[model samples]
Target: MNPARRTTITSAAVLAVTGGLLTTTAAPASAATTCTSPVFKRQFFANTTFSGTPKKTDCDTTIDQNWGTSAPTSGLPSNNFGVRWSVTRDFGSGGPFSLAVSGLDGIRVYVDGVRKIDLWKNTSTTVSKTVNVTIPSGSHALRVDYVNWTGSAKVKFAYTPRTSATVDTVKPLVPTGTSVSYDAATGKAKLTWSKNKEMDLAGYRVYRRLKGTSFGSTPLTTTTGTSYTDTPPPTGETYYYEIRAYDKADNVSGGTADQGVTTVDRTGPAAPTGLSAHGDLDGMVLGWDAVSGAVGYEVFEKDAATGSYTLLKSLTGTSYLHYVGHNETLHTYVVRSLDALGNPGPYSAPVTSDGIDRTAPPAPFDLAVSTDSGDVRVNWKTPEEHTRDELDNYGRFTVYRSVGSTLGADAERLDCDYSTTLDSANDVYSFGCVDPTWAYATTYTYAVTFTDWQGNESAPSETVTVTTADGLPPAPVTGLTATPRADGVLLRWNASTDADIDHYWAARGVRQADGSFKATDPCTRSTTDPLTALCIGIPDGETAAYAVYAVDKWGNASEWTIVDATELTITPGEPIGADSGALWGGGGWTMPGQGGNVQWHCEGAVCADVTEYRVSRWNTETQTYDLLGTVAPKDGVYYQSYTDATMPLGSISYYRVVGVLSDGTETVAAHPWQIRPDLV
Candidate 1:
């Protein structure tokens, strides 16, 4: 036979396609005696579909062939023919193999006589596929096939082995060189690597990690160029980087070793705020709100606006006291915050002062003392000598308490912020500090002096002494009386007989199961304030009872003495009808912690079943009623009363009584009572 006829006969003996794109079936074939490794049997068909019979066939040594814009073989068919080639060859070992097959039209592959891949279609582009297969450990039939439908006829079939699917299976013969550089001023890192010695190298990817954190997901950047500049990160943070190379086929190589770069802290901290300057007799006192991340503060002073400010002092505190050692009168000052690296931030708004300060604060006087068993309260008013400017320049006071009447260096010292104490029970007009170490029945003397911001100390004030009370509790309250009132119940009790009793506590109980009373909170009233001796309007009914305890100066309390007032009742009516007229004036000890007493009475038939009563105290600041305490109706008593010693001080305190029924409702007072509080 001729070479063309032999080729056609060889091709016709291998494959016969009936329909579909290159669907193959076993055809007549004979064993090839001229076979070699990586060699394949080539077959050609007449139709675009791999149907009918092949026209030509031959043995091909390799699959890397480019047949130009022509038919693959000349016989009976035109340019459209679905062809396939196959050969039984040993794979040495089979784990993961990449089979690269591409051509102008279409291609497919078969392993061990089984179709393994199919890209069978008409096309002008090349296509490839990689698959992992096992062929035992030895010889297996390998097939690389293609067909030319139209256009340029080109095909390539090649492969390389890989250990696994997701790892790089190819290594370059030549190694690559890499370098890194960082700019401290800009905090930017630039990475450069030598080009990979691979013809198929596609690009390089850069990865970075913070100093102590793991490398993040995804690469920092991907580029075909050899160099890349990274976006600058936070200051003072050190970062590490690495790179990897990949081919156009997406097979990656092992990453290069990591490199590290430490970025410098080039940014300074924010400026300070709320700056204030006060001229003192000695110097100026400068203070401001603390800056968040500042290590220190820098003070700058300038004589004129045209000139730049010169650094004066560095302070670790938020405030600075500039001593007037020189006669620099017309001075302007600005403050700046400094980072740990000694970088100064933007300056504060400048403050200009006219003259030097040399005046010392006047002596603080009129120091009074209130003594308990273990503590002595030293209260003093703001000195009249404390002028407006002096108070503005006030830093703090150095308090001294000597055991005797004379002031001495061995006296105990303390520091104070404000000049008066508003929360003290005794005096709202004076600032007080407590000495918890004072002994009972002992005499103590105290003295106070004043100082300015520049440390100019005034002479000591006149000394005062106080004798502490002995540790003894007061007597129990007695002589109880109850009356029915319009709002609730009215109660009255005689003062405790004990001389040392400074206050009284009245406790009320709500009638519970089995004829027992569940006690509520105890209300307090000072005994030294005579207007609070007889409480008038309490918000309880016949179901409640009352008891009173006497408390002494040392916080000692006596046993509770119950007042049987269950028989009392109140009839709800107009406001201020009962217990409304307090004979004492409003300001003289007429407030909570220093004021009046109340008694509640309920007269309704349901009063016997009353649970508790809620008393409302007016918040002088908010002008709204706040629930002070809930008292149970006093059982078997005609009327009941309670004393309140402390609501919020520093304003007029108002009180109202409301009877609580079993249904969780109230019979409220017509209006709340009013009194002026004397304590903070």
Candidate 2:
């Protein structure tokens, strides 16, 4: 005997049919059990006939059971009990099926109350039968009944669809109640539908397509569940979805009505192309080809060749004018398009601009003016960068001059142009020009401006005012006197009384035999200091005279103011002893330097009186003696020496020697000596 087959039972109301009046009830056990499709609700009765309320009820997945001479349950006698199993479900496009049963007692199988398999006899041995039948499509019910009279009680039954592809050619029904929803944030389209009713259904196939396009031959995805979530392109375009059912036999049904969803507008417009830029007098002009689907445009600009770009402007037009003020600077730019929702597109290729510089170089600074001999000289400085690169915009200077206190537009533009020199030491450009047209004893105003090659002029520099010098020389210097000293003759005088005195000139020379001075040269003194002067290294035993004059800024000069009534003899030192015995060597003396070399020898006690020796070189051009040096005597040395390396080659020169005693008495040579380096 086979074992009883039991299955899990769910709770549901039980309906009873009596005299065509349906009534709902439950057995005395506890509650009625419900079963899903393909599982059967089973009932048991105490008598062989199926009547009255069932003694027991439960769910059964299979209809095979056996009870060997024992009660089928707690209350039913196994020999006289009967059992029934029934269920209703969809078969889709219904097809051929087989119903089989085996029993030791009586058994029958019916489809919708029509018997397909029967073994109705209380046999001591098991009896079996099978029947083939065709069922129409849609919902239908099947039932099996068995009864046991005595001895062993057993029953088995089964019904199955003929699933051979060649025999079952019907496809599943179309999936119904199809619908879809969209989640904009996730860019996903969710599709849902009522579960298909086909018992042979394998799964559902979801299809998608763009609007105005047909669905593809292949499905987007296949799902065993009734719902699917699909990700669309999210390009702000409308898309459609459809649901279809496929069977285990590889048969697919027609698709349901298409459902549509419009995705979020996440895409922006295309990048702007054909961008261009050019320079105008006042700014840079830019243009580009129009972009499709673009509602506006964005312009970005950067000042230098390298750096991040920043937004310059946004507008609906395809062209723009970027105004750059007062500088010749290179500007780089890029452009992009924007949709109605303000989504930015790819940037166009970058462009650099050639812009005009309306700005002039900075005004010349630190302007100064001076007047001499009715000539006005102007000097100024400018930033060093102005002389390099684009900062060097101006080609020349425009000198403006006025006759009165203040300069105005009516002032004259000097006819001449001026250039500048870079004063690298000061890190500035130095500019100077002369205006020689002013009259003496008059006040004038001066200003300067830089002008570019295009004639654009910068703002004027600070103006300078100057009063011309009076056309008169200053009075002669007063209280002039000359005093002899060990180094030279000291000349002193009072300063010039004239406020515009430019400088004082002092000249001295040896007095000639005819009571006239010979070849007077300007003395060594501070030309800027008008009160005092020094005449250095005067040859001993020579008579000299000194004179001074005061010169005005207008180049006028006062009469010579002779020192000591114009005949002051300068005797700087006494004559050396006649027996000093100083004599120079003939040739090949290794002098201390090149060009001119001289060495002298002295003997006798007369040399003991010499504290130092003075060496002098004659200048034929100036008719004066240039002091070479002063040397202290070396004790016990045989000779004294000197070298004039600075003397030019191939020249004949006369040099003199003088001695100073230990008592501070200056001594002169009775006779001078001659040297011809060219001969040596």
Candidate 3:
């Protein structure tokens, strides 16, 4: 028999053995004695059987005599088994309990004649059956049956009970209540909620969903705090909040009733109204109505046409001043509100305003000059009214003059009040005056304008030109040249002078090969005195030129003086062969005109006079020219003896000389002269 085979015997068989079967009552006294076995059964079994006639098998070999037949029986027959009958019984309360039976090839159990478990077939060596049963907290009758055929007959049974108290039943707690309120000043919604309740309550989780949005269930917090505050809800947006309680035990409560709140975004600092912009000579002044609930306001201003708004000022008050340093016909203004939280409100509607003070005094648009007795007579119509409105009674026109770069400190106020009403509905005024302080040969710039009662002045009319007393000075002579010094050109020239000459201006223009000059603006000049000025260290190049001019105080400039520039070069005249008295009765000769300087010092017979040669010499030992003299300038084309006479007979000699120009510019003799004594 295999030791692995499992067989369980129930104690009911022992009870049956100890007390004779209550059903049959026909067993021997010894059979009625209690059988001492290692098996412990939890329940009773009776009338059980084995599949074969009672015989020795691995599982039933040790069975109690009461359960197995004492001798082998012919054809297997069913047998009955029982326990002492007791109809009054109960199992404990609150139980998930079960009863099981095993051992005989087949077996069954009953309590008070009601079948509880059935394993009646004899298919396997050991089989067991179990059933869930609930007893009423008392005792009850139990019965079983057994049979034997080809195998041993054995019986076993057990029972276990369970309770409901061990199961978990706790639930999450809900938020108690919610409160909503409004901030009248800010137009914002504020919300607060009550704390959750639970012994293991780890914290309350808050969730918010905007109106029309699916609720976001993600818990916001796990803290135990009960109060929460939500402020400044999104503008024009309604929000809802729900809170749930979570226990440390991982249990969660359903969400509380949602609190709905809406925020009004319309409440903002009022638009800046009643805007007034006043203009003066220096700038503009802007004023507007104060907006309610505005911690501060920002003013954005821009030119009326195609200009982007620029932040003019952020003022806690309602008034701002702008310096219209320059004339501006129209301007646009916008304002926005800023809150204490640093949040900015939407921009206010833009306000377009025409600059105030439209009255402009008539002034000369064109100025003309007449000369008499060395004085300049400046005449002009009163500045024409450039604007539509009439000049204020206090309005007056003034004229200013400047000579050759010299501006007059004082201006003459003209009584140009001769008013003429034109068909165009414009008031015209004219005036003329003579300036004895003007100088001859000088140019002058004149400006005219009107002044208002508030000291606000209109922009000066377009600048007008006038020549003071004739006999103008000649234009400044330019294109001066100087000796070359150390790779640079030194330039010096006489500064042009005019009777009214305010200053002399000097400029340099680099000349390109195409005869075009890159004119540079006045490089440097003395305005106070124009008699002397010098430019030094001009770069060395061809066709370069300089322009000098005299400038009048009025910005009139004299004609420019121009001249061509020059460049320097070095050259070696010609090359001569060594005087060896061989090939040409003395030495061979050749001239490499187009070739430039040689790369290496020439050796042997291939030497020549080189005027700045190309560096293309080859090494002879390497099967190339030891030193190829590509270019050789003639040393006078006829003065060859001086260069050739220095060569040694039957030996190669290399020759190189330093060539210098009259200007001290120097370069190496073109190509080194290489002389082969044999060639000579």
Candidate 4:
């Protein structure tokens, strides 16, 4: 018998085609070989009947291959043979699908053993048919059978999900078996889940949110794989995640259970704002708006425009007071908030201010007391006369007189019967006042001070004591002469005849519109130099008279001997000097200390030429370096200090220093110093 003729007899008995349907009496064949689910288990039969799969068996991932007029595998007949492909798989959330089959002789398809596509007939040309079907969810079986009876043989079959939005509306199944792992060191969260079984599944979406917040509409990521790695904000917050599956048709499944993670807090609180500074007699007062999550605030201070901001203080309140003692130097300030975890936020805007004036001038010194009949004269040296430093903001002199032996706070403040004299011979500026209400034989104590325009008074000068005498006063000064010199009127007289004469008192006064003589201030000269006396700082162009009297060792006084002087003018000369710049380490701190500090070295010629250095702080709002104060150069001091105890903290600050010559010439620095306290 011929090889093809043998199959023709068996095919005729086992199969028949009528009305585009296949009728098969062939028994189902069971294979000993196995294939993984979702992969087609293929079996070849020698006869058209698929009974007893002894010819060949294998696995195929898909059924779209074309076996053209030849055996699909070795030892299989090219004609008069049959091939069967079967698979059982999960069609999760199953939906509409397309079944396509084409073949020359015959082809058929069955879903779960129910026939769906039938084009079974021996033909010379290839026959094609496509059918739509719905597959239920869960495990189900599919089978494709092809038979070649005679002529050229070829077979092709395909099964695909219908993914068009108008055609398939079914969603993918929710992912399951979700788990997560976290790496604290790298701050990474990795999530994994079982892949969805839907053939139309597009991908999975991962969502994350803070623990207390709801998940956002947008997904964090979308991936086709079963695992994903994410990086959440490392602000030491608790966060949650959810997984969802979506289909190619844009249908999405419900989200899985929320997964949670706690991350390490590496973020700081927000910076405080609305920072403000105010000057008061107490100190520099700083305040700012409180931050939402802050537990405390740190105040930093520096000299305005001149040094690095130092940590002034840390407190839980929104306000702070920077105690700077008796100095009213302008300072710059910044503030930062701290979280409970001690993380610090950015600094606030810089603020500059010079605190209210609370500083007083040095006290007057060299107090002397003398007495005349019916009056007592008090004399003291001005602070400028002793120190010769610039008497800044000098207002006037205050003389206190006490009737008791000891001077105390209750001492009487005398009226403005004051006078200032520059004695050229003695090179001293003296102030004197005569308590004309005095009585004879009375003891008195006197003290004086220099006061600023603000009425801030210096410490009292050393006290002077004297007692009026009971006996008669010395004879009046004889041969009284008044000479007008450049500085003041020079008075000359013969020595007093009384041996007990202690000192002579001279009073100068401007004649008022009334003819009565009004004493300005009484000057005192001891008996050791009673012949001559000089009155200093008597203004020019004034008709003035001088009266001289004698005081005994017991404070007795003689009657006045008057001498009038001609008008004279004393003119001041023009100041002169050259610019001597204040040089330093680029305006930065030369040494470590409290608050912000700026140091400069100016010795030799430059130090000798410049009178003082002015320090300033940068003011952002004003766009200028506001002056803090002046620093004078010492004769032998090479390094000068510009320290700002109230520097801005948690911010970058700028500082500058300029030198001033005696003639009012200014020398500026090459560049302003930049200090980043936050970075440090």
Q: Tell me the tens digit of each residue's lDDT in model 4 across 1-680.
A: 01111111112112112101122222223447688988888877888888765576667776665566656654667788887889999999999999988878878899999999988888998789999998988889999998888777777788899999999988888899999887764678999999889989999999998977899999999899999999888777888999999999999999999988887575667888988776534566677898976878899886555667899888999988777644656678999988766878888888877677556656888898876543577888863332333243347777888887889779988885867777767767777787766666678888888776567788999998887656777887899988765435667799888877777677787655765456796543323355766554323467777878878876667877877787464321211122244455343321111245555665346557788888877676776778877888766554566656445542334566667888898775523342322211
Query: Residue 237 CA error for candidate 1 (Å)?
Result: 85
By TM-score, is 1 or 3 better?
A: 1
User: Which tens-of-lDDT digit does each residue in 296-412 have in candidate 3?
Assistant: 888898666676788989878877767564455677787777765555777766766555654433344655555554555555454233332334445555666655444456644
Positional deviation of residue 41's Cα in model 3 after best superposition, in angstroms: 94
lDDT of 2: 0.71
What's the CA error at residue 269 for candidate 3, in Å? Answer: 2.2
Candidate 2: regions farther than 4 A off: 1-36, 267-680
- Positional deviation of residue 146's Cα in model 1 after best superposition, in angstroms: 99
Tens digit of per-residue lDDT, candidate 2, span 1-680: 21332222211111011101112222464357687887898888888889877877777888777767777765687678898888998877777777888879899888899888778877999899888788898889999888888889888888776667777677778888888999764668999999877666789899999999999999999999999999899688999999889877778888899999998695777899989876544367788999876879999996574678888899999988787853656778899998766778999988886576444556888999987556678888777743543235436777899988899769988765344688888889888887757777888898988765455677999999989878787897898988664334567888877887877777786555766544376654533354766554323535567888888878999877775322233322322223244433322211111334445565556667888888776565676667977777777666576655444432334566767778887664522332222211
lDDT of 2 at 664: 83
Per-candidate TM equals 0.25, 0.36, 0.22, 0.35
Per-model C-alpha lDDT, please?
0.61, 0.71, 0.48, 0.71
Q: Which stretch of 10 consecutive residues in model 1 shows the poorest summed lDDT?
A: 6-15
Error of 2 at 85 (Å): 1.0
Q: RMSD for each model, in Å, please?
A: 36.3, 51.1, 43.0, 44.7
Mark the 10 consecutive residues where model 4 has the least summed lDDT.
Answer: 1-10
